[model samples]
Target: MFQKILIANRGEIALRVLRACKELGIQTVVVHSTADADAMHVRLADESVCIGPPPSRDSYLNIHQIVAACEITGADAVHPGYGFLSENAKFADILAAHNITFIGPSGDHIRVMGDKIEAKRTAKRLGIPVVPGSDGAVTEEKEARRIAAEIGYPVIIKASAGGGGRGMKVAHTETDLEIALQTARSEAGAAFGDDAVYIEKYLEKPRHIEVQVFGDGFGGGVHFGERDCSLQRRHQKVWEEANSPALNAEERSRIGGICAKAIADLGYSGAGTIEFLYENGEFYFIEMNTRLQVEHPVTEAITGIDLVHEQIRVASGGGLSVRQEDIKFNGHAIECRINAEDPRTFTPSPGTITHFHTPGGLGIRVDSGVYSGYKIPPYYDSLIGKLIVHGRNRVECMMRLRRALDEFVVDGIKTTLPLFRDLVGNADIANGDYDIHWLEKYLAKGE
Candidate 1:
């Protein structure tokens, strides 16, 4: 195990990794932007370093500054909590060149899996079912139109190197494809520095399910289970639940096996997620996340596993501690991403938090970094914390989540607490009868 590790992110994820390090007897050096000089992670870490200015390019996303911070702190490895440089293959390569391990997959694996188009190809080659559409990059508008024609109308143009729903456009007809193709290509180039986009048959009302898998950087891996993240808005996940009610044992096993095989085929290591879009009783590989997800706590809650610790152990050249047969899903777990924003407008509300309180009790887990008197920054993600709860079943889990959300309080800034309160009470969510677009429709109704 690493004696000391540098966390290359901030906010709740940084705090989450710090707690895991503390439990593993590993000292942590947390890197913070100048804007985050007084951040909770900075205060809690055994060592803290300011990388650069507030803008992500000058700070959190600055690879050299992060590597230098690790070198200075004598951190044996670097754990990128989630976003920013977490999925950057170049950052992983830099750490490897510095002889410091990155507590995730190898640079090669990330580079392969990071590209949505390439990942789909790899999955197809490995016999994993993928959404039918363009087999490769669509460089020309004609090729995109041709692919769309073959896949039928209502095809989706996706960035080769995209995630979080950016660089995507839907076209239902030939006329729509021409404009959607051009716009998607331009947006893809701007967002991911890749002009290449591909086509996929868009499934209406699909359930967003993902498999959480652990690997050893060799040919062996194990899957914990799946999470249903269908509760989303603008293609970003707002809520997640483990052991999706939408999936049965047979479906779970099939998807889990495919995910494990795909990861193992790529020699993936540490923790990662294989995302899929489920529709019409079939699962289609969407893409893979090469880092711990923001909603990982829900998986941990149901599995009784410490994913961060497992990440460190895997990075230290240790194989998975548990086999596939040993893994079992104990119960249902739900996670609500508590963002510092308005419930109605979805606009950020960053300011000094005059009062902060979190719910605690049986099966309630609050992963947070800020506290009372802390000022929420306007330059970063709107996320303030994560409220995760576990129970014997889905019904119990929902009840617990509602109770916990009710107890959570943050003053001096508007939050999504009320939105979550409404969501848990929504009939669609209560009956698990909603898809990815449910949240948007719910918000439209202003319920």
Candidate 2:
């Protein structure tokens, strides 16, 4: 086991990793920007280092400074808690070259799965189902039009290296294809420095289902079930639930087994998520996240697994602790991503938190790195916390979630708590009858 681990991110995730390390009796070193001098993670860490200023490029994303911090602290491993450098293949390679461990998959695996185009190809090769569309990048107008016609109208153009809904456009007919291609290409180039784009058949309404898998870098792997992240706004998931209300026990087992076998065959290590678009009882591969997801708590809540501890163990050459049959899904779990934003206007709300109160009770958990009197820095993501609830079933879970949202409070700044309160009371959300586009349509109707 590593004696010390350096966390290379901030906010709630940083604090999440710190607690995991402490539980395993490992010392922790947290790196923070000047803007996070008073952050909760820094305060609770065994040691803290100020890397740079507020800007992410100068601080969190600065590879050299992070490496220096590791060297100075004598940290042997780095647990990049999502975002920033978590999926950077180059960063993982650099750490390996310096004799430091990266508590995730190898750089090679990250490189293959990071690119959407290559990930699709790999998924298909691994016997996983995929959407029917272009074979590869559609470089020319003629090719884009051809693929759209072959796949039928209503195709989505996506950046080969895009995420978070950027560099994506949908064309309902042939007339819209040209402009959609141009816009997607331009956005892709600007956002990812890569003009490459691909075409895929767009489903009118599909639930976002993702299977969580873990590997031991050997030939062993297991899956922790699926999360229904269908609720979204501008492609960002607002709410997530485990054991997707859409799938039955048979469907869950089938998809989970496929993902587990794929990870085992590929010799992947640590935590990874295989995301898919599900509609009409069919699942189509979308992309793979090479690191822990922002919505991991819901999965943990259902499976009772300490994913961070497993990551540390597997990275230290210990094989998987649990077998496939040893894993059992227990209950329904939901997670609400509480962001510092206007619930109605959807604008960023960054200011001091004057009064803070979190809900408490059985089956309710709040993971946050903020407190009263703490200032929310605008330079980073506006997400201040995640409220996860677990119950014996979906109905009980929703009831618990509603009660918890009502008790959650934050003052001196706007938050999306009201939005969740309204959503919980809606008929569609109550019945678990929602898709990826449901949230956007709900907001458009001002319901």
Candidate 3:
């Protein structure tokens, strides 16, 4: 076990990792920007270091400063709690070269899975189902049109190195393909510094399902099941549920087994998510996240597994803590990502939190790094917290989630709490009859 672990991020995830380390009796060091001097994670850490100013490029993303922090604190491992440098293959390699451990997959695995084009090829090669599309990036307009023609109309152009909805454009017909390709490539070059784009058959009315898998880096791995992240806005997940309401026990088992086998075959390590678009009883691979997801709490609630604890254990060479047969799914769980934004307008709301209150009882958990009187800086993400609820079944889970949403409160800033309240009461959300496009359509209705 590592004696000390440095957390290389901020906000709720940083706090989440700190709690796990504390539970395992390991000391923690948290690096923060000047803007986060009063951040909750920094306040609660065993030791804290101010890396740089408010800008992410100068602070959180600065590799050299992070390495210096590790050396100064004598920290042996780094747990990048999502975002920032979590998926940076170069960062992982640098840490390894410095004799410090990155508590995730190897740099090579990160490199392969980080690129959408290569990830699709790897997924298909691993016997995982994939969307029918181009074999690789299509740089010329002629090739893009050819692939779209072969795949039929309504194709989507996506950046080879894109995420969070950027560098993506959909074309409903051949006429729209040229403009869509140009727009996607322009956006890709601007956002990721890579002009490479690929085409994929776009699926309508598909539910976004992602399977969570963990590995010990020694050819052993297990799947914890799936999360239905179909409720999204602008490609960002707003709500997530475990043991997808859209899937049955058999379907869940089949998909989970396939993902587990893939991870084991690659000899991967730590936590990863294999995302797919499920439509017409078929699962088409999208991409893989090489780190812990923001919606992981829902999975933990259903499986009774502490993923962070397992991540630390596996990274430290202790191997997986349990066998595949030892894992069991227990209940239904849901997570609502509460961001500091206008519920109706979806504009960022950054200000001091004057009053704060969280819900409690059986089956309710709030993961946040904010408190009353804390001034939320506009320099970072608008997400302030996550509310996760668990129950014996889907019905009970929704009931509990509704009650919890009503009980959560934050003042002095606009928040999406009201949106969740409205969503939980809607017939579609209540019945779990929603897809990736459902939320946008619901918002368009202004009901």
The Cα error of candidate 3 at residue 80, in Å, is 0.3
User: lDDT tens string, model 3, 325-401?
Assistant: 99899989999999999998899999999999999999999999999999999999999999999999999999999
The TM-score values for the models, in the order shown, are: 0.98, 0.99, 0.99
Ranking by lDDT: 3, 2, 1
Off by over 4 Å in 2: none
Q: Would you give me the overall lDDT of model 3?
A: 0.96
Report the number of clashing residue pairs per model. 0, 0, 0
Residue-level lDDT tens digits of model 2 in 7-105: 999999999999999999999999999999999999999999999999999999999999999999999999999999999999999999999999999
Q: What lDDT tens digits, residue by residue, belong to model 1 across residues 367-419? A: 99999999998999999998999999999999998889889989999999999
Model 2 error, position 139 (Å):
0.6
After the best TM-score superposition of candidate 1, give how far the Cα of residue 20 lies from its true spot, in angstroms.
1.0
Give the residue spans of candidate 1 off by over 4 A: none
Q: lDDT of all predictions, in order shown?
A: 0.90, 0.95, 0.96
Which of 1 and 2 is the better model by TM-score?
Answer: 2
